[model samples]
Target: MIRGEVYEYTIGNLRARIVVVSANPYNPQRATFAVILGADVPTPKSPSLVPLAAGDPTRGTIDMTRLRPLTRENLGARIGRLTRTTLVAVDDALRTYLGL
Candidate 1:
């Protein structure tokens, strides 16, 4: 999957949604694993949470602090894609969180 695509991922007994944060070239088509961040709506406020697009039906905040590597096998179906603006916001949040 390409970057900014949302998918369902199961971690242990918890099934959660995640956003594909890895660049397209480093995703499943080329790499064994990809980077991702957990996604949720109406969560507690934090600097690590980047607000999503207001127009999206599935609008939610992406938890930048929950970043992790996901295996290709664990990557689930495509749930949604982030808007261009939202993706840019996420990129900025990532940079800030990582101190880049």
Candidate 2:
């Protein structure tokens, strides 16, 4: 079974979760690998241009044309990184367990 902690972080009004797991493969008594999941957030940067009309009435314009699109892309990248990291950790754990 996978065991880990879920860490939450807020970017602007968005909340994101990051799951971290320490896997024990070698001895079943020691943590052999670390797995990180979630932790998805848009990179800390602004887009090139702002949209003409965007944002909530109470929050004002959010620059939908640029920031919104870029935010999605950034989030995707973060998720991709999380997935890769988790896979690598799992692979390592399996390899260690099998003496590969």
Candidate 3:
């Protein structure tokens, strides 16, 4: 899978969006990513999140709430990809959030 592609992983009852960002050569099963939750996405216990809607087909505001270092073992199927514009927006938001 390439970066910017959104994947739907089996997360019990929640259908969360997983973007395949940077992959780690050290661990093939894992990658650095952000979780995109729909507009109605539940309030996360953690306040860290970036708002995104530019590429989502549903056209709902998505929350890139957390940056996760996750394993591909749980990823189920390919869903879609975020646009170049959306990816740029996310990167900007992330940089701002991290005070970079």
User: RMSDs, each prediction?
Assistant: 3.4, 16.3, 3.8
Ranking the candidates on lDDT from highest down gives 1, 3, 2
Collision count of model 1: 0
| lDDT of each residue in 1-100, candidate 3, tens digit only | 6667677765667767777655436336557677766667565443345455655543443455567776677787777777878777667666666777
Which one wins on lDDT?
1
The clash tally of candidate 3 reads 0
Candidate 2 regions exceeding 4 Å error are 1-82
Q: Clashing pairs in model 3? A: none
Better of 1 and 2 by lDDT: 1
Write model 2 residue lDDT over 2-97, tens digit each, in one string: 233223334577654332234424223332222222214233333321111122111111111221111222121222122344334444544554
* Model 2, position 50: C-alpha lDDT score: 15
Worst lDDT window (10 residues) for model 3? 56-65
The residue pairs found clashing in candidate 2 are 17-39, 18-39
